[model samples]
Target chain A: MFLNLIRWFRGFVVFEIMGRFPERFINLSTRQGHFVLFSRPRKDNFTAALLLCDYRTIRPIARKSGVRLKVRERHGLPFLLGKYKARCGLLIGLLLFLIITVFMQSFVWTIEFSGLTTISQSTLKEALAEEGVFVGAFKPTLDLSAVQRKIMKNIDEVGWMSVNIIGTKAEVEVKEKELKPHILEANVPCNIKAGMDGLILSMNTKYGKAVVSSGSAVIKGSLLVSAVVENPSGDVSIVHADAKVMAQTQRTKSFVLERKGVFDKPTDEASRYRLRAFWLEFPITATSVKQSYTSRFETKSVFLNNTEMPISVTVEHCSRFSPNIYSLSQSEAQGIFAVEDYLYRLFSLSECESINAQRHYAETDSFYSMDVLYECEEDIAVYENLVVN
Target chain B: MNRKKIKSEQDKQNNSFGFNIKDAFSLKPRIEIFDNTSAVIDGSCGVLEYSETVIRVSLGELSLKLCGRGLTLKCISPTSLIVGGFIKSVEYIM
Candidate 1:
């Protein structure tokens, strides 16, 4: 039965291949609602040998030709050859279907984008074409994240960007960092007093009444301009005047400290070193590397608009700690260990810093914890716009 | 009689060695030949073989009786039809 089915299928294939020929096959002819053909191509003329006819009248012709013929009528073949021929209409339909399927699957139908920047849509689309991911690209092979990273790297103005493929389309969403201009409001009707006491350098007043001139000296918290004005009518009128009053005054800020320490032969004999391995242990470990510092580590972290958006990762970091006595000392034997340890830390921190060392010292074992104090200052020039009401 | 003689002569002239025996007669023939040669005169082309009582034509599916006959068709070869018949005249139409 299986063989018979295979034969039937093979016959179908044969019918399909032969059905493609034109209307002039030799032993082939169309009939009323049916067609039959003998397809015996001569070896040399393999393209030309097919004959068809109606069963109504070929009998006597064969008899006169003296050709012995056989008629194959299946007792249970179920489908007749004539019927099969009539159903050959499916061939054209199937061909059309295959052509349409191939056409539909050939082109890219959609595009999606993610992680885009201030880059415009058209610019991003053009950039995507450079990476072979344009409107018509085959979506499956496109590495969206890689394309996003490429775009972000190429356009550094982009603070954050992403490319995502949803279905057959690429969705590019960009997060652009825009620096907003700061608007400083000097709404208080106050005079620009001396920030620090110093000798009068030169006074420049763009607006408002300047009470002190270039040679005049002013003290801290002393008002240089007044918002009160006396007119010719002897009427006192208070106007909200805005001004820039610059005065140079003599200033002095000093810090004096007297140090005292009573250290008579600090005692240290033995030190114990503990080695703890986490070895995949999580949550908490055998030992935690917590620095015992007396001072807090000062870091300036900026949040997105100062509102706790996880964007507030650390920016500037200045740790507060004093070094370990042993680590501070350049002692011959301890120096090796310190050097090795520092080398390991330096290797681990290669992504974030360039280390610089200034000094080496040896201290007594007073059991003092690590402490760091920073006194860094910058000569900052600030604009003080005074407005008077 | 004249019609029969004229049909015989026409069969003699048109029927080639490989003509489908079923193409020329309505009386189903006992034998059939698949002619690679098409009908030189352009009617439904095939072959036929028949006796006085039956007709066989390579219409691919018909067993129509003409001039009184019952005919049965069987496969003798891939390109042949063996048609058996009962009674009456046979003729080649194409």
Candidate 2:
């Protein structure tokens, strides 16, 4: 194999000598410091052999030996090139394609970001693009550590990030920051005042003196706990007032429901299509209808041999919906249930201790009123800075 | 007696160099046969006769005839030739 490679590199010719005493020709050639490989007799006097020499050297030898050397085959790079010399454009194109392929392999063709929840992919991609770490960017020019530092500094939500460039794909993995819960501290001297008018159910004072006991009916903004205290020797001191006061409160609300209303109903009409391309998107199907529609998009990237490529396909499902007018009669409207739902919403909106009793009064055929008595617990302290006069 | 004495004096003079004159200058051909199937002859002059069963190569003062079945000249250079086949015998003729 090694000898054949050398022979192919230097270029050789396999020819046959058809003349008188071809054996003499071979002898003369070998005797004059020429290489004759695989020399065998053909028909009567004709001998076929492979000469491991240039054609220029063999021409003179064949002429001097008075033998006709017909080249039956030529093998080597130069001979092969000469044979395809007429189609030079095709050769150049093939060479150019190889060069372009090697050059394109040095760029990032696909960028994939994972482990993102609160932070959007587009925002991270934009940040990466600013650092010269996006698709079509040169791989060697990207400083991953610098890019990571820049992303961590620019995006406050990002806690950690890792940028890994494998071949033509860039994989960015990230973790987001977790938010801590807020805690409110009472450090200033203040009085605990009534947040609403209610009958006091219970009072538990951690600090300061309780001025109002249980079963005391107080108005809004009335002090329930005092921050100032007096000793037996006429000495006074101010302390931060802290207490939990449970109270019973009353609430009344009215809700009116109409006999008819308009509602949007989803129909079974939906259109789905796919778009596929490399680094560019071209929708293969027509656009969905211009009506109001809710759409869902799913994208899948193409990978060849476990390596992600720039080509991807996106499928879109668009569902159109129209409004439907629904009506209900007086008896079928279920006004009590609607009022109860409204009361539940109102109670959820306000902080309360507990509801004691609920009463509903039907004022008219279309009007319904509800009265809810709630037992609540709240902090009613208000602070006024000490006026030094 | 004169010729034998002259040849003995020449042999003594040649051995004075501590090596055989033909081996020191590589003036003689070296033939190596392997299991009667392949033969390599170095310092060959040229081909004398070539056929399917016999190949005669000239090596200066001596000639080597390779007798084999389906004999072929695998390689031939200026001073060496490699013959491969089912070789039967190699005869040296002066």
Candidate 3:
């Protein structure tokens, strides 16, 4: 194989010698320090031989040996190059393709993420990009340990992470931090008291004496469960009081709404689109409307397969609106039904278990005042530390 | 009697010096064949005969005849030659 390669590099030829004495031609060629690779006899004293020498050297040997030499075939790199020298563009294109293939092998092409639940993939990718580790980044310049440390430092929710780079793809594996419940101190001397004024619906005392029974009303800051216990021996000791006290509580809130106000109503809408390439943006449409309008922007980036490029198209929608003074009618303004609707929304927002509301209103010539009374079932137990003397 | 004594003395000197007389002065060819497919001749003079199935190489007083199918001289230098093909037999003719 190595000899064949050398033969190809230094050009070789296969020629046939036709003469009376072909054996003398071979002997003369070999004796003259010329390299003869293989020789085969043809029909009627013509001998074909593969010579590992330049084509120019075979003429003198064939003339001296009194034989006519005809080159049957020419093989090697020089001949191959000479045959394709006319098509210069094709050769240059082939060379460029090989160079580009080798150049592209040194950059990252894809990124894969796994074991992610809470931390977003975009957040991790953004952090990785800040540390110079992203798609299209050179692989040799990246320090995996430093990138891992930077990601961990940037995202506190990650407990442990690993960044693995394989060929043109980078795989990111992460574990999220576990959430732990808060633990309270036990065996402390404390009393459970009412945090708000409420009627006791149910009381479950675990380690204390219940001073207030079910269906009894208690005021705010009043003690419902006591930590002090007196035994038959006339000895008193303080203990931790643990209980769950469900009660019905009343909450009141009041707010006033203006009968006449100015509101903006959308009347006209227009949109403009632009393409963003790198740091420059090119407007695709010439629909720039500069007016008092509310604009909403939607950007869509181009992605080849799963890898994201830095090219995107943004569409901005502009809605032009005018403000007009809107006034309520006399009957609608004086009606208290709107306050009940707002009060129901407020009760739902507060996440009450069960609620009932009563509305009270006072109206003037221009505005109305509304007060809402909300009764809700809620847990009203507040812990108070007991002092021992 | 003098020539015999000198020959005996030369033989004794060669034995004591561990020298081979044939290796020192002989022009005999050394042929090595690998798996009956290729042959390397160390002391080739020139090509005596050329053909597809037979190749005869001259080495001073002796000639080597190689008979095979699809045989060719793979390489040839001033003093050595490599024959490659499906070699069937090799004969050294005096």
Candidate 4:
């Protein structure tokens, strides 16, 4: 039984009280009863004595005790011990596995890079690798400050980089540096003028003449938008007119659009699903196709460990074509208008008070083409100060 | 009876052993053993005339040399020496 206990401990079932066994005690099993007594004694002659006697033949040491002794008396091992030992093999296996898993998790398994533009991913990965923060390196060993310094030293384009350990994955958030724009500080004479039309609420004539007062009316190209002016008191001051003048005005714009559509392109291919470990490999054997394609294949690639591996699978899809021609449907034309509007806003073109748009011309030379005319008008300042004070 | 001869024998025993060659001259002195012998004077067999190199030996090896002083065997190697610093010169005992 003791040997079995030692074996269970060796298999890591019981770990806490392994080394606490008494050295001078021996437990023996006999036909009479189980004996647990000291194997060493204080006398110098005989080392110790360990014996067992039948319960009926030997007198009870505590005959006056109220408690009755039974052959299989409860030993009061903590109730949890038996429960723990019942499934010790599985519990111990799971516990050991959990410990090993935790050990592995404390180290880095993947290093994900985020917010990288202008600089290539491979270049950033290489820069990070030089700082000892690459894949498979221990996460605890990473000194983020040192890595930041090293990255800044190696790549001048990187303004700052933040490193964070999310469980077993290391995330490197990068921000490419912004370069200061060059400012022309020449001594050439220049001017500033009213940039927009609004009621001049406030004005300070710093180095230029105030052509229009707070309530004065100024036309779009009126002299109130001063090109050059003379101050009072006959000092002949050549003011730069480096002051803002605002007044209310109006604007108008127009656009002409002409469009056509031929046969709608046939289905190129049906969307398919392919399972891969790292999105690097795709084959048609496992991927199911539902339709056909009438267009050429376009290959898309994804990067893994600095290698650009193709992940796209192509299969030709086509449908029988009918000799048919068509015009732009209202929905398609509205979609185009939405896209045009979005592009116009994105390009920062001025808002139009009016639009004069028309279909200028259209042609069908292999593909449909359209010519659009857009016209616009707005109240803009014409007279700008061209002299410095 | 042979009292006079016994007396002479006793007298000889009272003095040091005849093998004690400490008072005798050594053809190769201690200075010669330690000196750079890449240069040797003319008429010296298998020896050089002039060189600046110095020979070195460890303390343990020197102790071995001191212990071999009483042995009547000489080493003839260029890089090794056997000093028979005791009575009489070495002879081929074999």
Q: Which lDDT values do the candidates have, in the order given?
A: 0.42, 0.76, 0.81, 0.44
Chain A only: TM-score per candidate: 0.30, 0.57, 0.62, 0.44
lDDT of 2 by residue, B14-78 (tens): 77666567675766788888888899999998888777888999999999999878888888887
lDDT of 2 by residue, A1-389 (tens): 99888878777787777776565677777777666766775445444545345455766777777888887877887788888899999899999999999998898898888899999999999999999987678888889999999999999999999999987789999998887766434556777888778788888888778999999998888888888877779988877777888777665544455456688777655556665543456877776665567777888878888766777778776766678886656554456545565567566635654444454534445443344443445434444433335
Could you arrange the candidates by TM-score from highest to lowest? 2, 3, 4, 1
TM-score of 3: 0.62
For model 2, the local distance difference test gives 0.76
The per-model DockQ list reads: 0.04, 0.50, 0.44, 0.00
- Give lDDT tens digits, candidate 4, residues B1-94: 5999997776665546553254234333232332221211111122111011111122222311122122221222223333233322211111
Listed per prediction, chain B TM-scores read 0.28, 0.73, 0.72, 0.16
lDDT of 1 by residue, A1-389 (tens): 79446545434212211222222222233322223332332222212111222333444433443443344332222245455677777867888899976754543444454554456777777787887776456656777678778877887667777766654345567787686776534344444555544444455555456676666555666666565667789987654444544433221222221122333332222222222111111222232233432222222233344322111122222233433333233244354445644564456334322233323333345321212121211111223444434
Report model 1's interface C-alpha RMSD after superposition on the true interface residues: 11.9
**How does each model score on TM-score?**
0.28, 0.63, 0.62, 0.38
- What tens digits encode model 4's per-residue C-alpha lDDT throughout A147-219? 8888888898898898887876678898998878965333332444445444444455555455677766454
For each prediction in turn, the share of the native Cα contacts (below 8 Å between chains A and B) that it retains comes to 0.03, 0.67, 0.77, 0.00
Window of ten residues with lowest summed lDDT in model 4 chain A: A13-22
